[model samples]
Target: MKTQKNFRPFVAAIAAALLGGALAGCAPLLVGGAAVGTALMVTDRRTSGAQIDDEAIELRSASRLREAFGDRAHINVNSYNRQVLLTGEVPSEAAKQQAEQIVGRVDNVRGIVNELAVMAPTTLPQRSGDTLITGKVRASFVDASDLQANAFRVVTERGSVYLMGRVSQREADRATSIARQIAGVQRVVRIFEVVDATDLRQLAPVSTGTPATVAPAPAPAPAAAPAGGAVVTPVR
Candidate 1:
């Protein structure tokens, strides 16, 4: 009877150990899934529109990148999910390399994919307002074309517009005019490299990607202000 009692205790210990090992194996997967879900939720809550939010972030990052390079004369920035894609013409390979370096240094960037053309700098205003104009024109293109819509990225820095992706020159030209027509648009910049217009696809948002279905992560409270006013970019 004492042996039987001791056996029962050993069995219980073995069971516990197995259970612990199983949970340990699942822990990393669970943690990873939670983190990804949290990030997506945070991204969704922070922006009013996903595409618009992406464009704004891209524009802002592009501006910062150009400034950082100190050669804002050329270059356009497009952002999708923290990945920045630069497309446009630069005067030299050195300049092209510099643009990549500058964009990589920006905070929150997952990666930089530069498609900047190395050629004579085309006449385009690389100003903030110009980039805005470019975005407006791209929006018009989306409204008019039967294309997947999100397949194209439009970026304007100054008055120059850079269109990136596998788009026809006709499509790019149309996009350019759209930007030029917008008010406060000084000049229209075109840095589009035309290619086969096919093979573009847009990823459908997850079935549960809807705002209400996913709960946003709770943001920490803001820190106390320093002795002097300091400027900080909002996460959104």
Candidate 2:
């Protein structure tokens, strides 16, 4: 329960570690008493090792992306349990496919949700709006007593909201509905690794949460993504 007060990991993730000192507020498990990283691991569905790997995956894939596209693309690489979700803008279709191909080569990456749009990078105002929308969505999750805010990871890009995490089918639908109600959300995407209720209980036996995490969603069709889940990723 102590860690609940510091439940803003989404902000850190969405900002792609660029929040710097701002993230320090939630990074510590104490103020928060425990190691901040340790605190997150306690509640995260991914094992501590997976959490670490996710970080590495993001860093490695991002470095590759930057090398491949430089200032031409605006990509945000988010790795949750080693399933990387790529969001942002690129100049061409070739750039988009190249981005996915580059990320797919990263070590430990089991799959990818390539949500990169073939367009120019968004302006600061638009990105700032996306940040605010992300904040509002996160606040809504916290306000929802039925859900564990930290159980979800949110990404808002150009009004579209993405949800990601390991959760139950009921949690997925509930979380989706919650996100869709947010005023500025253009759409809600589900990149959830939906688990059986029995398995969810096994992960957190005392958890009574009714909603899950956010990943970029589709507006009209399923992505060409491989659509893998937590089960096949093979980790603790």
Candidate 3:
């Protein structure tokens, strides 16, 4: 009976693996849809309009890429605050440039960072390993006390990690350090739009009844006397 119990667990694991494989194709769509819905309701730094634009940029870019490259390339389009990061494999340098050009034309794309390697497409197993590495890196960020984990986006291709977001220099550096410490991460790339902490503060909406700081106007130059005018000064 003990032997049978152990065998049953193994059988259950095998069945679970099979089920996962069967559903693998729908996983990204489901996860991405859920994340987008949740993010809209959360405290993300991006304004709701900017978030919507970023999503539109990603979708448009993907559609354009499909029309241009079809199955000849493996491209992953990630847009954060309208800055797009392109990662994956293309067949040639020409194709790489073409891909970037295509994405650049997408409306609302403020910038593009093309990190597509000029190589053959990676196998499914290799892609799965990269996904695992990305998950580990993301988990580490969540565990980090100093980092706002959602302030960064993590993408892993092969063994290289790509980080994207609008963040202060400190946050970007901290995130890069965390990703580098993960095993199987051979490289870390920063595609962040680095901003000052003050900039972030300025972007935040002022709370009710909070006074806004205004610069003092320069003292009005003493009223210029007419060419030969009276020297009497106005009373203060």
Q: What TM-score against the true fold does each predicted structure earn?
A: 0.35, 0.74, 0.70
| After superposition, candidate 2 runs with Cα above 4 Å error | 1-36, 204-236
Local accuracy of candidate 3 as per-residue lDDT tens digits, 149-188: 6676667777877766557767766776677777887766
Q: Note the residue pairs that clash in candidate 3.
A: none
What is candidate 1's lDDT per residue for 41-127, written digit by digit as tens?
343322324444454455555566555554533554654444455655677788778877776666555555565677654453333
lDDT of 3 at 71: 82
Q: Please report the candidate that would top TM-score against the real structure.
A: 2
Report, for every candidate in turn, its global Cα lDDT versus the true structure.
Answer: 0.42, 0.64, 0.62
2 or 3, greater by lDDT? 2
Worst 10 residues of 1 by lDDT: 25-34
Task: Give the poorly placed runs of model 1, Cα more than 4 Å off.
Answer: 1-60, 69-72, 124-236
Window of ten residues with lowest summed lDDT in model 3: 25-34
Model 2, span 1-236: residue lDDT tens: 75865666555434542332122111101010112276777887766767777777776877788788778888887766667777888899999999989988888877777777998788888877776667777667776788887777777778877777777777766777777777778776667776777886667422222222233334333322222332111001
Every candidate's CA RMSD: 23.6, 9.8, 17.8
A best-first ranking of the candidates according to their TM-score comes to: 2, 3, 1
